[model samples]
Target: MDRNTVEKRVRELNDLLNDYGHAYYVLDRPIVPDSVYDQHMQELLSIEAEHPDLIFPDSPTQRVGGEILAGFSKVVHEFPMLSLSNVFNEEDIRDFDRRVQAGAGHSITYICELKIDGLAVSLKYENGRFIQGSTRGDGTIGEEITANLKTIRAIPLKLTEPITIEVRGEAYMPKKTFMKLNEARDENGEEPFANPRNAAAGSLRQLDPKIAASRNLSVFIYGIGGDGSAYGQDSHSDSLDYLASLGFETNKQSKRCKTIDEVIDFIESWQARRQDLDYEIDGIVIKVDGYEDQEQLGFTAKSPRWATAYKFPAEEVHTKLLDIELSVGRTGVVTPTAILEPVRVAGTTVARASLHNEDLIREKDIRIGDAVIIRKAGDIIPEVVSVLVEQRTGDEMPYHMPDNCPVCDSELIRIEGEVALRCVNPQCPAQMKEALIHFVSRNAMNIEGIGERVVDQLYTSGLVHDVADLYCLTKEQLLSLERMGEKSATNLLTAIEASKANSLEKLLFGLGIRHVGEKAAHILSEEFSTMDEIAKADAEKLTSIHEIGEKVADAVITFFNNEDVLEVLAKLKSYGVNMDYKGRTRQEIPTEGPFAGKTVVLTGKLTILTRNEAKEQIEALGGKVSGSVSKKTDLVIAGEEAGSKLVKAQELGITVWNETELVDALGEKE
Candidate 1:
């Protein structure tokens, strides 16, 4: 076919596919058969492959995802994405209604929407074409995740009409998809996500857009970014309708309540029937319908007064406490898990609940074989609420935590100021296995193919023990393991080799140090510049660096001083692992700047700069930006409507500077 004919065919295919996708994914009404969709999709893919130049940005084939991102860039939201205040009980909901009525000076219509338990995101469009999508990071700033968002078929690449706008929504995973994901993770020996919300959030945050696409995430656009009036909408319900009309997915379950009583009834009905839904909803969001009324109500420092969320009470069920099992974590803390008789709670079957520690078990007087009342905290983690003493018989046996490690049989020791007993034996098999899993995790050494199951296989097979032993893995040894194919084994080894080139911070974080987290690892790497320097530094010198507290210092000292850790380090060095910091060195940071060597705390909202930008600027000038104001804070950069942190700074007599002063100090003109 000629170029013009090919172009026409491409356009025709795009329109047809997009319409079919919208009808199926967004509307949940399939307009075409699976075979028909696949045939069209294959034709489009073949055409795009043949004529790459003809592929449009909003082509249906682009939803498959493109290249992997190195990292997400920070995006400053044009308008802040404020959270809504929560109302728990009936009284709280009534009080919220009273407050809204008093603020508006009249009766109000409330638009009640399901408070989807997922990651909140802002989607931006220019001339009706999707431009960017981001998280609701601290309201004012977020990470750019446009590629991931584009992969979500429910999110329209182009609107029905050409218009520039920004909309807020909740990106979520369906319960069925979440269950499948967890099952896959379980099979792969990877940690399962706590809930559908976490799965959605985790999927979106992945650097690879393909991962997000595979997760089958969907979005429910709730409102416009700034105001509905800008779009010629008079009320929130109208905005929802307009959004839906624009090819956006808006929840159809949302109701326009004329009175607060109706709103309460809606919430009550949902609280009872929530389990029947395909996705998770934590609460019901009640918003004043009129834009004029919302303008009058305005917003507080954190949340909008015009709207509030009514959180559902946690669902509880009574189950027999069959037994209690203990597991040792990477840090050697033994956690107790209550094995309960299978019972359904919060839409999932609950077979086990976290008992937290020995103290919790004793405090609640929980015993094996006793009838216990349990509930899912935050609709995720199952916990024992109370023992049903009335239902319990004298046959129930009291439970006690063992003094020795169940796996290694080492005598457990309880440290001062700590409640849980720890297995101090560094050679404990359970600890070693957990540490190996942590070492290969995404944030650590990032050996992608090595999961918990692989670690267990290697450990049990006696081919690996410590993190350093991973470097010694042979392809022959891997091939001997169950489910290990030649290609997967080769890929695993390649990943392991690639990990050897990672900077010092990755190794430090992967070492499973007691209190040294990712941030602390980065800080230590930056301060010391080399693992050797960090190892040589005493506790006093380590603690002198800002953000490296005594706890981290002690942990570092303890880690380096250990003979076993030293042997592991030696082996790792022999494997030619990179030990130097790859990020900006300490010398690159301005040593004689205005904020040099000062511990600064940022408070409130800055109109000019986002929080991350300000924090980065402060760090560049050798200033440590802390999250909270304390005695150690030498300066507080207070912006518009600074709250309790500002008050605390004033009480501590710390020097305070406004945003203008901060900019001026940094030698930048406003």
Candidate 2:
């Protein structure tokens, strides 16, 4: 128990764990069962907790468990991981070949590789040992992911040669791992990721390396990083061999093509043969053979001129549509899903397909009992292809979306110029649960470990009927839930507590209003920093804000004026959640000025600043935000709901700003 003794034990444990980690992760062999590994890890954690000085910076325990970070730490790539420009058609390919041929003179060979649909990463080695790994952020700098990258066995710890070098490659989840992830998400009641690329991005971006390690990520090294030191190579294909011999896992399917025809052959072969693999391959990468040729062709600021990616078409399968069922979204928007007879496509069984909106359904003439073709759009989600009416049965049912909310029975209302019909009920159970979840999501309250299944459990148990009820949960309440232990309960509570301190903008987006979205919420947040201010503001007052057109203004006023809605907000306020934030309180602040370290969204038309200018100004200020109003939204700049976002902001009382106001504010801030 003494520090002196603990340090020795810690050293021993770190060595043991690191070796075992290497065996299990890098070698794909383990000398101990996971139980034993867990026991050892627990002992190490206990020892480290007892004597903090005993934990090493590179300890294995540091990789898997830790507090989620606010953002990823940036690392400058010693050699940039450049993006390949895309060549969509055969003419583009010939054009690329023409350029390469002109650059290298007479004849030019190419290296063709399957475009692994995942994030690009770079690994650096010094004195034969892996030193750092980073993402391809902006091609110049990326987030440091050494701990996560170390978990992949394909990534070598030590190179065969003692040369200091960097390797570029794709980090992907196996189709099998992606399956498990989807299953796990479904089991947890969380929305499944759209594709394996998303799964890899989410997993690898985790602040906790342990979470990344659990995802079973793999890597395939493709290019050798160019250091100023490599004065020797005349072409790019030669570098591939140098990297291949240096203990890196390069692609086996890569080909050295002497002509564009060969490149086309490689592309067509992979297009047909991609199904035989256990992973997803979206396209093919064609690169000029020589580094000299690549340089002669030169680079655009964003992509290399010598290389191009040719994407494959999505995989489609013809099958019989058995029935049509409508699944209600969290917003009470009923989406029609085609429940088809089971058909295999894209390495998994497909039984259901998205019908998009009613308009799309009508346009496609899709119906129950119709023969249809299904495709994994981009090899990700299932969608219906053209219906084979040539084989339709007389028993086929013509589908119609319900006019009322299935769960809340609220009359569905579609906004002007919008295709979606939505329930306006704030108290709707389905909406409430989904809203609460959105509120606590990473973009909103960002409560860690609180996923969809856990949200479902709270709602099902009646412990959480609304957003305010989540704050009322105690350790005992959480621990009593399935799979929630004491430590988990404490952590969940801590995350929830932390979320309460988030800026008002996030809260506004998470409220699940019909029309308000992220951009509108940002606008609203800056206009009324406090929920009280927004709640008290009338439709006219709301509309007075820039971009708050009549449609959006009316929706906002309707949401706040509801009695039940007022009650919920009052309860949430009483529960100690901050209904106000500092960002929105100042009118003199920039409408478009970089809300440095703050997130903002723009919706509708801005009278003061153009949309692009507003976005640019925000980015310039070091503030980051995106489209789609969700819990993650920091502010919404609304010219109008332009749709659901306007209503959402009013319900949540997020700040609203007109385009002119935003443009003027942004200019003034700088």
Candidate 3:
């Protein structure tokens, strides 16, 4: 085929696929069958592969094709993405209404929208083509995530009409999608996300666009970035309609109410029916409809006075506490869990809840066989809200934490300045089991085919006593275990062998040293470049590094001093485990730069360079960029619309530099 003919066909295919995708994903109406869509998508993919030069940015095949990003850059919003003040009850709602009326000096129409339980994002378009997308990092600044956002089919790459705009939305995962994702995670021996909101956020923040695409996320565009009147719309409702007409997925459930009474009724109606929806809604957002009224009511430093959110009260259920169970963690901390009679709360069955510690148990006066009110904290963790002492019978037994470790029979000791009891014995079986599990976890060694259950089986069968024992496993031994087929045994051994090549940071994190988390592990690995260097460092040398405190230094010294730990290290070394940091080394901070050893705070909007670029430049010149202004702050770089941080810097007598001054200083350093 001729180039012109092929180009025409490609254009036709792009249009058809975009239209079909919009109908199916955004409007929830499929204009064509799944087979037809797949056929066209496959054709597009083949054509794009054949003629890479002809591939357009908005091509159907271009949605998820990008190299994994090292990190997200900062984006300053053209207009601030303000938050809404919260209204908990009817009284607060009525108070908001009164304030709006008093501020506007007239009656007002209101728009009520479902508050989607997901991440807030901003989408920017130039000439009706999607240009950039970002997160709501701080209202003023956000992280760029255009590649990840493009994977969401609900977000149109091109608008119906060519016009420049910036809109805000909530990106979310449907309940069905969330369940499927958790099931996949379970099968892969990965930790399941706590809620759909977290799943959505995690998916969007992925460095790889293909990962986000696989998660099947969607977005609901709620409002424009600035004012709706600029788009020739008089009110918020009208603006939503305009957005829908422009191929944005605006929520259709939003209602225009003439009175606060109608708004209250709408809120109450959704509060009961929220569970029936496919997605999660934490609350209802109430906003004054007319732009004039909203402008008149104005905004506070944090949120708009014309709008407020009515958060749904957490669902509480009463259940009988059957018994308290204890578990030991990798760090030997003893945790108490409450086994409860099965009861539904927040659309899930509650069989157990964490008691946190003995102090909480005694303070709440919790007893076995007592009726307790339970609720999901932030719609995720189930916790005991209160105990119904009046409903409790005399047969109820008082619960007390055991004095010894249940699994190892070791005496438990309460560490000074800590709440929970700990088993100091490093040889505790429970601790070893937990450590094995952590060693193979996603953020650590990342050995697939090994989960909590597999760890338990390995420990019980005496096949693995420590993490090092995992490297010595044989396929024959694995196949001897129940439900372990030959193929499964081979896969587990392969994964264990593969993990030996991981960088030093992964191994450090897997070791589960006290006060050493993933971030700390990475920092230590980068600073020392090798495990041996880290082990050889003294507390003074360790504490000299930024973000490393005396506590972490002490913990590192103690961990390296242990003979058992040294033996494990020698075994790992003998097994060919890599101990060198393989990741990119951070730039060294110069000691002789103009801003050397200075703590600088950047506030407001930067016009010359992005916030991230400024931060990098500052750090490159041996200056540390802090998020907030304090007495410790040596300098403040104030830009356009500098707010509280600027004022605080002035009040604290800190040296302040405007954008021009900052540019000059950077230029001098260069």
Clashing residue pairs found in predicted model 1? none
Candidate 1 vs. true structure, TM-score:
0.62
Candidate 1: segments with Cα more than 4 A from true spot: 1-114, 118-128, 131-154, 159-168, 172-218, 222-280, 284-311, 591-670
Q: How well does each candidate superpose onto the true structure, as a TM-score?
A: 0.62, 0.54, 0.59
Pick out the ten consecutive residues of candidate 3 with the lowest summed lDDT.
Answer: 584-593
lDDT of 3 by residue, 349-371 (tens): 88999999999999999999999
Q: Rank the candidates by TM-score, best first.
A: 1, 3, 2
Full-model lDDT for every candidate: 0.89, 0.76, 0.89
Alpha-carbon shift of residue 616 in model 1 (angstroms): 10
> Which residue runs does candidate 3 get wrong by more than 4 Å?
1-115, 118-153, 157-218, 221-279, 283-313, 584-670
Worst 10 residues of 1 by lDDT: 624-633
Please, what are the lDDT tens digits per residue for candidate 2 over residues 261-289?
Answer: 99998898998889688778889999877
Count steric clashes of candidate 2: 56
Task: Compare candidates 2 and 3 on TM-score and give the better one.
Answer: 3
Residue 328 C-alpha lDDT in model 1:
97
What tens digits encode model 1's per-residue C-alpha lDDT throughout 97-129? 899889888899999999999999999998988
